[model samples]
Target chain A: MMSNTRTAIGVGAVALACILGSAQLVAAPKYEVVELAESGTIVGIVSFDGAAPAPQKITIPAGEDVCHSDPIVKEDVVVSADGKLRWAVVSLKKPAKGKAFPADDPEKPIVLDQVGCRFVPHVAVVPVGRTLRVLNSDGIQHNVHGKAKKNKPVNKSMPKQMKTLDLTFKRAERIPFVCDVHDWMKSWVIVSKHPYYAISAADGSFKLDQVPVGTHTVQLWHEKYGTLTQEVTVAAGKEARITFVVKPTEAAK
Target chain B: MTIQKHRIQLMAAIPAALLTITVLAVTVAAPGCATSTDSEPVADLSRAEALFVENCASCHGVSGDGRGPMASLLQVRPRNFSDEEFRYVSAPGGPPTQDDLVQTIRGGRTMGQMPAFPYLDHTDARLLADYVRKLRETGVAKMLVVEFADDDEIEPDEIAEIAEERVAPGDPVAIVGPSAEFRIDTERGRALYADNCSSCHGASGRGDGLDLPKDELGNPIEVRDITSGRFNGGAAPMEMFKRIRCGIPGTPMPEASALSNDEVWQLVHYVDLLAGN
Candidate 1:
């Protein structure tokens, strides 16, 4: 009775929230695992077709001798000369069915480091139910806060010591993290229930394997650019190749 | 919208909507640590103020200032909602974001004056959390955007661009508050604190030293006790360095221009000791 009423409120709030910045008020979906021996792969490259705008110059505010030993620029969009976009999140909007429970992938912990007061691996992907090891190596205090919609959010302070904050995500979502201490610092942590999610490389290429063969909604998200979605079909044991082109901030207008 | 954008909108809704009691019929929409962006769905605000006045007012005060009647008796004072700094905020190093306030309010701390209020039902607790967040957000907004005219307020698109110019890289920064950090023995730091800081910060690093300072409003500002565990300039070494090097504006805490990079680092160690870390 209680949860039923709550769902009603969530549903009612969704329309109002969408108007205010297209916020995702709809309760993010939960993850379920079922075994599937026959799986396919989704591989793609994220690139910008038009001219890449100059990087945003980020001010360190303080800690010049340490935080920004060198001039640091915000990586809102890291587009190389070859048109490859770095740090783009490529994920399935709503993953229906894919691989089974407890993927065979090595259970190595995903590492997120605060080196130079910045999140190393500016963009990363982790499977749901897995813990991400958040390390503070800069020997300076840094805080880790995630703005998550579907999964649980974390707001923890990492002491300068080699402390590891183990945070686990229970659902799938595209989460963005920031360091309140260093306002310029930002990163994205994308979570997926199955092995059908990947972050684009510095060269803008990404590959998602072990996906159940079917048509699925693929989405690309960038902190600077809003979001774009597409539908593609993955054949049995075949690699479905896709290309996503995002609008750079300057060109978007 | 992102969380930051919600801060602007929240300012308009919270104060006026204080008595509105916009309750969302939901029990606790969020399951685990799930959080949402701003543009929060409007809900009935109830027992929040009532619960606060009844249970929390003794320590948090009627207006949320750390000036409850029991405030003076306690070793660590209650939080001052109007103050700009809040150490336990959910946001990283900055002040507590709305969700942070909710979590902290729900799970009150063990060591300090904040006693966990498990008695408040999730719905009642959330109502109270929203009210507490409104107070903190109002205070932060006033402090951060005082210079801009009401009509000329900073917009979403302009923040990143403005930061580039106002907060240039490589420039010495003004310190704001404390955060968690690394530490070693404070023997040398203890000496440095004795020589430089103790006169104002107290021998034990509590802000109880002689010759206390005052803010611009002529209110007597107590010297910060490192042990109190709340900081105006975060607790991290760099945050401490930012404070030590640049110092707080319009206060008796002057910058340590003479101290070298290594010397300031040592001072941070000592201060942590005073905090009983």
Candidate 2:
């Protein structure tokens, strides 16, 4: 009887140890997965409350022609209908709850090109610490001049057939790109530290993904138009839709 | 009996240990401990004011008036701080446009009384320009005079003739020479320049043409102020002639290939008078 009792006790102890070991293994993996669920998505449209005006042309002085030929469409700057606020930059002023995306690499920068005296894209989304490649596709020589107040000013020549020139933005800036060879050519590149940003298209659509589920603020920015902010609550596994209306201010007019 | 008791104890402790571990992990991973540093305070006004006094007071006046002791001596008085009317502008009005102010301070108004403050560094120049605008707002000083001239409206010949009339024979080479024999049609040149040049270069050739745009980096590319004698690369008549014909490499000023060589010379001669040469 004594031997049987001792045997039973030893078996119970072994069983308990195995169960605890399995629990530890299961708990460790689930912990990391749960952290990911906290992240959510942010999406919305940035539309003009009133009439969107036709594109206007702005001329620079004779001596300072960085981008000469193309008519610069002031798209980023938008005016609200109320006409009070103007020239606002809408961005995620804070980081999200979880791990942030990796910082951009400066040595290998994303390139922005100018072909036929036109900036390739009307808008550019760049990560901070990453290099921006500027290419001149035209036969004529062009100067790639950047007007960033905080970052270094880039006024280098892009000679004909020049394949590429690399530039890095150290700080966040909405930099304007001009080609002195062609006056009307103009474009904007937005440098951001965080990856959770999207510029509204001409039709006014934007999307921000992988946001942690919870209450958060979404910011809307217009070049001429002021900014509008909205509070949103994101639920787990559901797509959240929000709309932001920006009124034009008198200053924008 | 002993075996049964020990089994019960292990079962109870397992749940409790797991709970404690999970709770601790969640607590450590929570984001509340991370503080946001985005709202850090900018430079204090006193520091900015001292910087302004040290660098800008020489030209923009200690009180933000265009009336520093250097103001009276400058050909175009430093922009009067009291007037609040900024003529050389790209944006119509909203705050003195950063581009105009930056360009004025960095590149200096070409041939104008304002000299480029490149020594201030771009960042410092920007901060100083911002401080100046604040001064304008606080009414520390106001622009007392507002002057506007149509450069295209006045011809070199007319200006030369006016200079001739103003300066008797050889009166120390006044801005306007007194040589009656050098008479040319000021009206025709004014019309031509107004129609062709004023769009990019302001009506007064002050580089403050209408609706100027900011550069990619948000810096203003100002029109060269031809009325003042300071030219960026060179001020010689031949240099002006070459620029008019070939155009400057990085600027908006285009080469007037459409105009004849002689016409470029006429433009150059007219530009010289506009420079007060």
Candidate 3:
């Protein structure tokens, strides 16, 4: 009888341990912070290969005074005059360990401003765990609706009276933000988990500094063309240059 | 000899009854102890699937993709679970809480487009909700795999791991109902509605507002005609309060975030008055 009791106690203990272990795993952090002795940089330019499509025109609603004043155009695919691709996010595909993200201050949080019924910057990069202040500079009733994959989606109305709303995401993913009132207003916010990421400038130039010294796979994602990857090798204290040529997708045409 | 036999019988019976009592105590207490753990109980997927097939498959699709045979006939398209799009979530945007799904299943939409399954026991409703969640998790995992197809670094296992973490629902938004002292002020509500809702819902709640409103999927959405006396969320004042506090997800309806709690109640009363409730 004593032996049977002991066996039951042992089984119950094991089951309890398993339950506790799984709960811990659910809350475990995906990325780890490590001190690096040496690191390199990856600089690249993203260019459009095909003939630029004509800018898509957006029809302004008749009575919205704030939206009617500005000429709104589709920003799904924006290219520079000299074939430089704009708004492509470039980053390392998988970085398990890296430098710590810069400390984020609540007072100076990353701003995703809504101006003239359009999200400014068209594409914004906000660090994971950092606060993103959604500003309604347009002074109109605009809702910031975020279709987030890895984070809790945000939907809140910012009327003319309400100026700002603050939010934060715990995971890294590209979230699409749109205004339902003005359906044409669209934007993307890339919540980056690591510092090894950059958005292409108007000149199509992008740089990822302090990437670990190794041959790492680089990823580029555009709103229209989807995700593309290429590999580049980096040496200690050196810079590796790579170029990504993007073409319009069938849907874009 | 008879006395000796009776004593022996009592001795055996006492031990047997004691054993039975011990077993019954352990059986009853085991489940109560398990609920104290932090981890949720493991969902019975097969049971959930069977329940979903029996009850929800007619409209929600056998695969939970919102493409059942009766889908085309419905005015409001049945929610596409695979797309991870839900309309009435307590939170602003949602991978809705399990409770949220259960509420919808039990209550259905007030408009009666989707019939209520009040006959199903609470346990069965929960199983169906879990099944819907499984469908969404699988769909999201597949989408990730496709989005990162070219990258050799992101394995299928890793994508699945990410999807599991990403699809965990956020906490339900807390709703505090109107206080006992509250009164329906339709006069104040009418003024508030004109300023806040008239642009989208029309001056008389006819839903012939500005331009056509479209959902996130770019599908043109017909605004709710409030005069019809049917609401997507529910007719209860408390339910209307929740809808006003947290906007309907996936649609163009914006939350009245700028309004005070009292003001929202006033607006709700005004809407009810408009619908002749």
Per-prediction TM-score, chain B alone:
0.42, 0.38, 0.75
TM-score of chain A as modeled in candidate 2:
0.67
| Alpha-carbon local distance difference test for all models | 0.57, 0.49, 0.70
- DockQ (Cα-based) for each candidate: 0.02, 0.03, 0.13
In terms of docking quality, model 1 is incorrect
Candidate 1 chain A: worst 10 consecutive residues by lDDT? A15-24
- List, residue by residue over B36-147, the lDDT tens digit for candidate 1: 3332332554456567667776887655666778888998668766443344432222334444455557677654658777777777777776655544433333323322
- Alpha-carbon shift of residue A236 in model 3 (angstroms): 4.2
Best first by lDDT, ranked: 3, 1, 2
Predicted candidate 2 versus true structure: per-residue lDDT over A145-250, tens digit per residue: 6654334334554544456777777655577776554456667777766666676654456667776677766665554443456778877776788776665542
Per-residue lDDT tens digits of candidate 1, residues A83-169? Answer: 999877777655755555454343567888887877888987777778788887776655576755333334554544436777788
What are the runs in model 3 whose C-alpha is more than 4 Å off? A1-32, A236-238, A249-253, B1-51, B68-76, B95-103, B121-172, B179-191, B216-218
In terms of lDDT, which candidate is stronger, 1 or 3? 3
* TM-scores of all candidate predictions against the true structure: 0.51, 0.44, 0.76
Question: What TM value does chain A in model 1 reach?
Answer: 0.77
Instruction: Specify the highest-TM-score model's number.
Output: 3
Clash pairs (backbone) in predicted model 3: none
Pick the winner on DockQ between candidates 2 and 3. Answer: 3
The residue-by-residue lDDT of candidate 3 on B1-277, one tens digit each, is: 0001101222232222222111111112233233121223227645665677677867877656687778988987887776646677776456578888889998888664788889988998988776676666545544453454333233333544565565566567677766787887777899888767776788899888857787767788778788887887887887787777777776777767788888888988998987778
